[model samples]
Target: MALHNKIGVLGEEIAVRYLKKEGYYIVERNYRNKFGEIDIIAAKESYTIFVEVKSRSSENYIELAQSLYHKQLHNIRQAAIFYFSEKNIHLSSIRFDLIALKIDPDAKKIDKLKHFTNIIN
Candidate 1:
């Protein structure tokens, strides 16, 4: 589709790979409900993590993790609750995480990646 959309898809792929490397068992991608979407849903240890992935061409402009605004967090939380209820999952702990991916044009890989955990209430 559009260039920006392509970049976003790439960034999401990179984020999933990175999470897998970190030993997270990915449960779903682009999990959505009426409220909004959660880019990734993963499990590690005893916790279920809802992830938001942000991608940018460069980190020089802005910190990608900062892009997750309060409204977005609210939507994610709503979606997470819906997902939990629908899946019949009674998790003892849940977490929200943001994964920022900085793309490298030359290498066709992520230039930088940052993970911010427990980002929402």
Candidate 2:
């Protein structure tokens, strides 16, 4: 696989590990719909979370929050809704999460990790 693709896969793997460690029960990964893909779906408490994982080799001055754009958020929301509709899940406590990671390319470990919950507004 391409280096970028490999990096993304590794990032998702790390995100899943982190979420599990934080007491989230993973429901799915790489869920796709006609709209787009959700990197992870997890449950914690009464909420079902849809996560978007973004990875970079370095922070490189750009803020992770600024890196996520409206188009991407739109797709994630659409996909999440599609997933819920298909599953017949109608819980009011649905959440959108963003997990950003800066991975050390040489070590294949996280240099930095940030999780933002309820990102949609």
Candidate 3:
């Protein structure tokens, strides 16, 4: 895999580990269709979550909030709809989450992880 793709995979792994630690039951990962892709799917309490993961190497400097684009958010929503329809899941509460990772280049370890929940309605 390309270095960027590898970083992404690592970031998703880290995100999943963090979510599990926070008591979220992992439902799926890399859920995708023609619409788009969801990096992770997890559940906590009454809320089912759709997660998007973004990772940056130590050499890269960018704000987490600015890293995500409007179109990416749009596609995530579309994928969430497709996931629910296909899986026949109907929940009263749904949430969108974004996990941003800062990885150390030399060790390839996650230096930090920032999780933003309920990004969209």
For each candidate, what TM-score against the reference?
0.92, 0.92, 0.91
Model 3, total clashes: 0
Error of 2 at 41 (Å): 0.4
Superposition TM-score, candidate 1 onto the true structure: 0.92
Over the full model, what C-alpha lDDT does candidate 3 score relative to the true structure?
0.86
For each candidate, what is the lDDT?
0.86, 0.88, 0.86
lDDT per residue as tens, model 2, 36-70: 99999999999989999988886632477778799
lDDT of 3 by residue, 82-101 (tens): 88889887854899988889
Worst 10 residues of 1 by lDDT: 58-67
Q: What are the per-model C-alpha RMSD values against the true structure?
A: 1.6, 1.5, 1.7
Task: TM-score winner between 2 and 3, please give it.
Answer: 2
Candidate 2 lands at a TM-score of 0.92
Error of 1 at 4 (Å): 1.0
lDDT of 1 at 90: 83
What range of 10 consecutive residues in model 2 has the weakest lDDT sum? 58-67
Tens digits of lDDT, candidate 1, 15-88: 99999999999999998789998899999999999999888886732467667778888889999999989899
Which is the leading candidate under TM-score? 2
Off by over 4 Å in 1: 60-62
